[model samples]
Target chain A: GAGVSQTPSNKVTEKGKYVELRCDPISGHTALYWYRQSLGQGPEFLIYFQGTGAADDSGLPNDRFFAVRPEGSVSTLKIQRTERGDSAVYLCASSLQGHNEQFFGPGTRLTVL
Target chain B: AQSVTQPDIHITVSEGASLELRCNYSYGATPYLFWYVQSPGQGLQLLLKYFSGDTLVQGIKGFEAEFKRSQSSFNLRKPSVHWSDAAEYFCAVGVSGLWNKLVFGAGTILRVKS
Candidate 1:
């Protein structure tokens, strides 16, 4: 009955640091996705995972961003050498297979100073 | 590339008044459209979705949306709005040929006045 959950609801870090955002998808959900929302803008696709493997990573901005969902339940998005430009709310969502509707979690807002 | 447009950046309506929010999307094939509402410090909540079948789809909180292919629009409407309904609304299209990756428009901020 629990929805998707993200840890560290808010994180603040200095530029050039590393941070990791975690997402725990709903039980029995086979698909997971990550998105980023900047100020005054809508959320943009980042990456997606199906089961334990990432089905699509094209939306990842660069190599500095990476995610893993080993065991197919929990996912962690890792950012290397963060930049001020990376400041934004990171959202995670999950859905049942074959369904178009995605249930989103209260995103983790990452701030780089 | 799939895209969505929310023509209005902001709209204000009196509580208990009818409301309509416009959404237009561009895609090559049949589109999976959706409306989501986001309140401050909260996650996006799905209001409704139009995948197929009937053009008019009903969703949570007494919200409904009509899909018009000819107009390339899927506008959200409600007969009466409550003050608590004030928030940001987003129009999104699920990218075709991919796994339900959504393309969202710059949201419309809804303000409700008593």
Candidate 2:
């Protein structure tokens, strides 16, 4: 892909439901990131991946929020027992290497109702 | 931990007027600063970034930013505002040792009046 791409542009799920958001980063990029943005606020860092390993998951809100970049290209963010507070736009970004400028995706808007 | 602060929650500027958005950050060492713009229903677009050397950096779309190490600030400026420039602006700071995980400010909403 020319840029980072996220799937299921929007998702609405009931409370306590599980959801998975997908992200496909640009080819050859070694770094990927996930962020969550609430209305009227800036995007908050959620997780970061370097190659096939998660370099940083400190930003994930809790254990329920898990992300995996198995092949170092495509990544998945899975949430368990969703809550209304979890409703937000999930963004994905990719960069050629660590500490480099990142290219962002259109983002997936997840609504927990 | 690195963090960014965009003091102005909302700003309104008339078309053709000069524009300046303030940003401050807290970082332990030489910080990598960035500015991004987001229009409604759109993804974030990097305006400019400051890594090393020049304190003043020029970005795309007629945007520029100046990094002040003393004040711990990196402010975005445009010579003239356009109605099309109305959007949300975010200031971010990245830790030098961290692996590109950026900490972003709350964001400033710009409303350009024609």
Candidate 3:
């Protein structure tokens, strides 16, 4: 893809339901990241992947939030037992390498009702 | 741990006026600093970055940021503001070492008045 792309531009889920957001990074990019942006706030880091494996998951918030990038290109963020507080924009970004400039996707606006 | 702080939550400026946005960060070593802008319903776009060398770094959209090591500040400045510059701005700090995550500030919203 020419830029980072995210699926389901908007998602609305009920409490206790599970939701999945997908992200497809730029071609040949080796670093991918997931971030969550709440209303009136900047995007918060959730996880980072250097390749097929997650290099940092410290920012996942809790056990309910998980992400995977099995092929280092496409990534998925899964939230289990979603709550109303989970409503926010889920953003995906990719960089040619770590600590470099990141190109962001359009983002998935997740609303948990 | 590294963290960024953008003190002003919101700023209103008239078009063609000069603008400055303050940013401060807490980090142990040399910091990789960045400024990003986000328009309504859009993702963030990098405005400028400061890796090393000169204290002043130039970025896109006629924006520039100066890194003050002693002050722990990386303030963004523009000589003239445009109506198109109305957006949310974020300051981020990355570790100097290889392959580290970026810690971002809460963000500052800019409103341009015609």
Candidate 4:
């Protein structure tokens, strides 16, 4: 059985550029979540998806951040006009429905220079 | 809003010494508490969780946590820490609802001295 996986383990981009981080959740997981971790800080929730629809997105910082899980197995977090402040490690997690435990991925570090 | 607090910014303990990491959370009603460890370049790993029944919960890697409602705390403890135990520990509270949304603390860095 495979665990959660994220692509582009590390990404560096200029300010005002766009970047997309991909997450492949474990097989049969019905819930997905995205979090951001800054230096010297813990991870903060960004968005969450239940199945193909986003159940809660209040944690998204702004409109520039968006995520989609079209097929219910993979998710992509898109950032538009990235800013230096947006630089951080983007983490992806998945869990079985009705389960409290969340399995996290290795994360994609996004650097906005 | 539910929140978590990890007062200790950093802790250093000998490999054979006892270890305890304090965690306090603020949430209404019965809260779902969790302890997670994050190693360098690795994803977050769950250490233990407390929901109901016994206040003392045992978890993987010889780790355990005690939930004290009076103190609103769930502190992680281990009898003897190993050098490989050095990492960042996070205390999180899960908001009980249709989806379990986690609210995490600032985290405490643990250093194991051999």
- Chain B TM-score by candidate, in order shown: 0.97, 0.96, 0.96, 0.96
Fnat for candidate 4 (0 to 1)? 0.62
lDDT (10s digit) by residue, model 1, range A1-113? 99999988999999999999999988999999999999988899998888899988989999999999999999999999999999999999998863556889999999999
Residue A88 CA error for candidate 3 (Å)?
1.1
Model 1 residue B58 lDDT score:
98
lDDT per residue as tens, model 1, B1-114? 999999999999999999999999999888989899999988899999888899999999999999999999999999999999999999999888344599999999999999
- CAPRI-wise, candidate 2 is medium
Backbone Cα, N, C clashes tallied per candidate: 0, 0, 0, 0
Candidate 4: list runs displaced more than 4 Å.
B97-99
Location of the lowest summed lDDT over 10 successive residues in candidate 1 chain A: A95-104
* Candidate 1 regions with alpha-carbon error over 4 angstroms: B97-99
Return the lDDT, model 4, position A4: 95
**Residue A7 shift from truth in candidate 2, angstroms:** 1.2
Docking class of 1: medium
- Tens digit of lDDT per residue, candidate 3, span B1-114? 778999999999999999999999999888889999998777789999888899999999999999999999999999999999999999999854443577889999999999
Candidate 3 backbone collisions, by pair: none
lDDT of 1 at B4: 96
* TM-score of each prediction: 0.97, 0.96, 0.96, 0.97
Which digits, one per residue and each the tens of the lDDT, describe model 4 over residues A1-113? 99999999999999999999999999999999999999888899988888999988999999999999999989999999999999999999999973648999999999999
